[model samples]
Target: MASNETPRQWLKRTAGRGARWTRLSVIAGTLSTLVLLVQAWCIATIAQRMVIDGADFSSLTLPLMLLPPAFIVRGLLIRGRTICSARGGIEIRQSVRRELLERIAVLGPFWARRQHSATLSNRVWDQVDALQGFYADYRPQMLLCGIIPLIILVAVAPLSWAAALILIATGPLIPMNMAMVGIGAKKRQEDQFQEMGRMSRHFLDTLQGLSTLKLFGISKHQAQEVHTASESFRRRTMRVLRLAFLSSTVLEFFASVSIALLALYLGFVYLGQFHFGMYDHGINLFIGLFILILAPEFYQPLRDLGVHYHAKAEAEAAAEDLMPILNRRVFERDTDQPAWQPEASIALTLEGLSARYAGRASPALDNVTFELHANEMLAVIGPSGAGKSTLLNVLMGFMHPEAGGVSIKEGTRPPRALTDIRPDDWQRQIAWVGQSTVIVSGTLADNLRLANDAASDDALLDALEQAALKHWFDALPDGLDTRLGEGGRAVSGGQARRIALARAFLREARLVLLDEPTASLDQASERLVMDALARLSSGRTVVLLTHRMELLALADRVLMMDQGRVRALDTLDALRAPQGPLARPAATDIPERRDV
Candidate 1:
């Protein structure tokens, strides 16, 4: 993953993680080649004694008896290679998946929002899975290509140097031709990977928004998009296969031509038209037959390598997408570093903080400064693109400030910079609930456990009751144990949001960050969530981002932001003045601070 490092190089570096099993596969393959030489020698001796020497059947007993066991041992060795290779593939995949998940965790939810969930899932599963065949078959085969062919050449050189020379000459053709074909194959494979991710993301989006599409009469348009993507992927796949077939053809031609040329030379030597291949004398039936048999073995490794060359291409293409994520430099935070401690309630301060997206023209949070006293509620109101979410992201520890900083203090402790704290320690004290809640494929209890893994059944029930979901829970056929979420039973959007609120309750975090928690809920759902939120927020610090001006009344102060800059910060009563930015909100939506 160094600058200018190729994908193939990255794959080799990754291979080191499971080198033990790969080494076992290599050992078995090498031993199998040696056993193959023994078997070939036995075949040649038997043919020579029977055909040329006119020996009786009884004299051939030993060679014939040794043949079956050698075949069995060779089969066992091949099986051992397969077993070792599979284990190596599993280890490599496990290592890669763990790294990917860890990277996502470190990047945090704010960064993850910028990427497509389906695309990330493809990287986690499909892209990583594509490497299995390479580690399991192509890697060991590539290594044996180097060692096995050399062994075959050595065995043949003593009997027929001309055949060995043919092997030496023709061996490069298969790999050289394969390399040429692989150049184009790799480009196709990379394109395919990209198309696959795009298609997956597209499909997931279409499915998730199917109701919206139907409402707008645009479902047909999305269907056509899917068709277009599917056709493109199919054509790309066919092109890769065509290259694969061409590579195989090239390998077969070179190997066949080399073996045929050796056969002709052995025929001439037998017919006494040639006299120059043997070490001490003219070629005999045993020597010629052994050399011919060993000639094919010399090219076998190269042919096997040709067949699996596509796997190498596939793995490299997968690595092309994966290496950047793995090699991305992350700030190393010290576990033992001193960090600010907020006790009893929360006190927050931001100073001249600035942050920007990768390709943006301006900072998302530009020199924004703010303060909130212990147990205070701050409502951040902004038009879209106004640093409201960015401020919450920084406070929630999902992102760090690019310039300036944030600090926290409680009681008599001195204010300390957020960067001074371990990220884990900072996150432990904050509970975040975004607009949408993710319900994974699991049981109702399993989904709830994601919040607090050790929460007892009674604790979970209590949390559900606290979220106003006690009736919902009781109605389920199996109660807490009932299967829910996808692949089980779907819950309404309200239930999902409440489940998130329950997590916040279970966490008992001192700071509560809500990013438009009631944005898309129905009137009843919104009321239930607000009631739960008020309970969760009471006596704890709260930073709420919303456009709901009615909800602003619940806050001690309302901060207005525009174009990443704070426009105003004041009490809701003050903002409601005719000269202030706020327009008075209707009381029917939400009435009192405590009732919110």
Candidate 2:
């Protein structure tokens, strides 16, 4: 997936990675084509013996008997080719989709949130599916177009070189027409995909914000907008389909013309207009009929290729969208198992740390330095867009800083750069609860065990109890077996955050990262969340990002930040002093509901 590689090249390269499956299909298709040649020769021989030599039907029994089985064998080979190619497509699609998911995961939560869910879904599912048609239908057909037609030419050459010459001349017309049609096909497919993505993104946005639209009395307007977008997408899709159909029609016309010209040449030889096409310097019924019979078969592969040509165009368009994400620089990891052993007493230091997102003017964390000892609860306070949570992302191992760095030191161990720590082992030590909770579709017990999937149901129930989700769990009809998340049951905001807390408890990690976990909860929900947070942080090191002042009660020290730079880092009482940087103001008081 080089930056300058064309989409078509990318597609072929990706498909080539699974060449074993393509070879299986190509081999079967080649066999089928060879059988087709035999079938044609048998038919021509039978007609010559019966009609030209005045042989009786009884003498033709052997060839007649062979016809049915030849037809059956050819059909079976064709079926096998189709099945092999289809299965190959399935495996390739699965592999690509799995790779896309892994890439998404490694891109980290910040990258994940930047993508709109619907656009991401379309890229992973619909776009990946587009690649299937290329492997399943187009690849084999494309190869057969070259192999089968040449086989036809070689078979017919001995009987009538003139027919073979005609085939060679006329055959290029179909492919030429395909080339002209293809010039527009790729653009149309690209347009269609773009429109589809635009429509899907808008539709999903409207759906997610439907309540807001209605509250603002603009739902109808948005409905109209969605309708407009859908209509535009429909038109683009239709245009793409029309381009595909136009290519097929042109190809069929050329193939039919090629076959007809070959027939006319054979007809001329039969009427004694010419005798030079035959090897014997005299035309016979067998030679004439054989060439005519195989005429259309010569162009058959070309015709099939034309029909499936849209698949290639679609795949190329999909590759254009897929390559960027696939080629993204994912978080690095150790190939071998890392032998990192952090001591029980962990200390972390950030020195002149500067960081920014992929495309941003200002750094998200700018020369910001900090230190934390084991079991210390560091509360980071900042206003909106203050980069408070960005620090948490860094601590959570989601991303790296552009300048400066973080290092960790364990008791009796040399300091190691945080980036040197293997991501797997580094992540295993930290449990994170973000503002938005992703509860995948699963049973409640399954959702709670996300960090430690092997956790037993009883252990999950206990963790839920510790997180104060026990009452919510008890209210469910199926208890631990109750379905949650998408398409099952939805949890309230507080419940979702508490569910994350339960996961943290089950994780048994030494370090915890909480990103405004109780940002928008009501009094009771906030209290429950705070109580659970308190219990979860009892022994674990916690980095808490908060905007609420009341939540600062749990912080052993407060780190105030503004515009990606640290403003102050001191005890609350010290920061509240009149001469201190964060001198007390009524505005500094966090909204109520800090205590459990």
Candidate 3:
């Protein structure tokens, strides 16, 4: 995936890594070629015996009996070729997708946010599928096209050097013309894939935003935009198809003309106008028929390779998109890194911490610093654009700091830098409740078990009770087994948030991070969620971000932030004293929580 690598070179390198599969395909194709040579010889010999020898039907019985089984064996070999090619395709495609998924896992949500999910899904699924024919059909045929023609030439040379030279001379022309058409065909295919990706992204976005469009009464206008995009994609696809068809036409033109030349020479010699290209017998039906039969077979593999050339072009297009993602460098915890386990509670410290996003002019968190004590609730109250969420993200091991650092300590052990801690180990020790929850396509119990897979039914019920969802749970037709998320019954936003809270309650972690846990909720739902938060935070160190005055009562201290810098970190009483920015009077006027 180096920048200097051409698309063809990149594909060769990737497909080379899965050489075992490619080898299987090549071997199958070679066996098929050998069988085809035998089949052609058998058919030609039978025709020569009957036409030139004028043999009786009784004399032809032996060859007639053998020809059927020869064809049967050839058919079986062709079947095997197909099976081997398909298997190779499946194995290679699986390898690419597995590697892609692993790389994406290391990059995490930061990468997902920057890309359209539909685009990624298409590349992983449909684009990978496109590579199947390249490995299965095109690659094997590439070798067959080279080897099979030489084989035909060698077999024919013993009969007539004239026909042998014709095949040899014309063989190069097919691949030469193929190379000429392939360059433009490949470029067109790549452009078509890009257009497809854009269409998918646009369509998915429009679908997700349809409700908003309806609200603004511009749904019809948006529909026209979608239509235009779809039409553009259709036109691009047709262009690719035309190029593919043009390449086949050029290959067939060369192959047909070569066969015709061989036929013309054989025809003249057969009719006695020409007396050359024979081994003393001048020209007989046997040799002439054999050489003529071999002519088409000589060019058959090349024609097939040309036909499946689009598979190669399609796979190259997919690889152009896939290679960058596969080669992307992302921070991943070493598997050999020591796993850290804390005793009861943990304390955290941020010293002059700073983080900047790509293409941003300034750091999202600049010289920000704070401390959280064990078994204490610390609330961060910050205006919009004050880096509150960035701080939480760093604590959750989702973002790496660009400058300064964070450290965590438990019991008597010295504090360790956050970078030194493996994310999986550290994340296992804490539970988080974000503003919006991800309700996956599964049952309620399945989602809850993601937090603590070992939790029993009783444990799950207790967690639901703690999240103030017991009443809703009782009304459920299927209770915890009810399917939620997409393609299932939908849950209210408040219910979804509470389901997330239930997951947190099941974790029983000593550290909890809350990001406006009750934002945008109805007053009653907010009260219920706050009650759940109160129970979930008991005896746990907590970091909460909120503009809700009611939740500030739960915080022992408050960190007031503005413009990516901490203005003050002091007790709630101190922050509420006289002229403080977060005083009761000013806190009441602050808007509902918003992400920084």
Top-TM-score candidate index: 2
For model 1, which pairs clash?
Answer: none
The local distance difference test score of each candidate is 0.85, 0.84, 0.84
For residues 1-596, what per-residue lDDT tens digits would candidate 3 score against the true structure? 47667767877876765577667666766776677677677777788778877878887777777778777876777788778777878888898899999888777776677789989998899898989989889987887777878778878888888888888888888878778877887788888888888999989999999999999999999999999999999999898888888888988999999999989998888687877766765567777777777788789898999889888888888888888888776766577889788886889989999988889998889998878899899998877888888888788777788889988888888898878878888889889998889989999899999899999999999999999999999988898898988887798878888989999988888789999998878988998899888988888899999988789888989888877898888987787778766566646465565764
Model 1 regions lying over 4 Å from their true place: 56-58, 215-218, 335-343, 583-596
Residue 595 in candidate 3 has what lDDT?
61
Cα RMSD of all models vs. native, in order, equals: 3.4, 2.6, 2.2
What TM-score do all the candidates reach, one by one? Answer: 0.93, 0.95, 0.94
Task: Report clash pairs, candidate 3.
Answer: none
Model 2 spans with C-alpha error above 4 angstroms:
331-337, 586-596
Report the lDDT of model 3 for residue 144: 78
Ranking by TM-score: 2, 3, 1
Residue 333 lDDT, candidate 3, scale 0-100: 59
List, residue by residue over 122-154, the lDDT tens digit for candidate 2: 999999999999989988788778788888888
Weakest ten-residue segment in model 1 by summed lDDT: 587-596
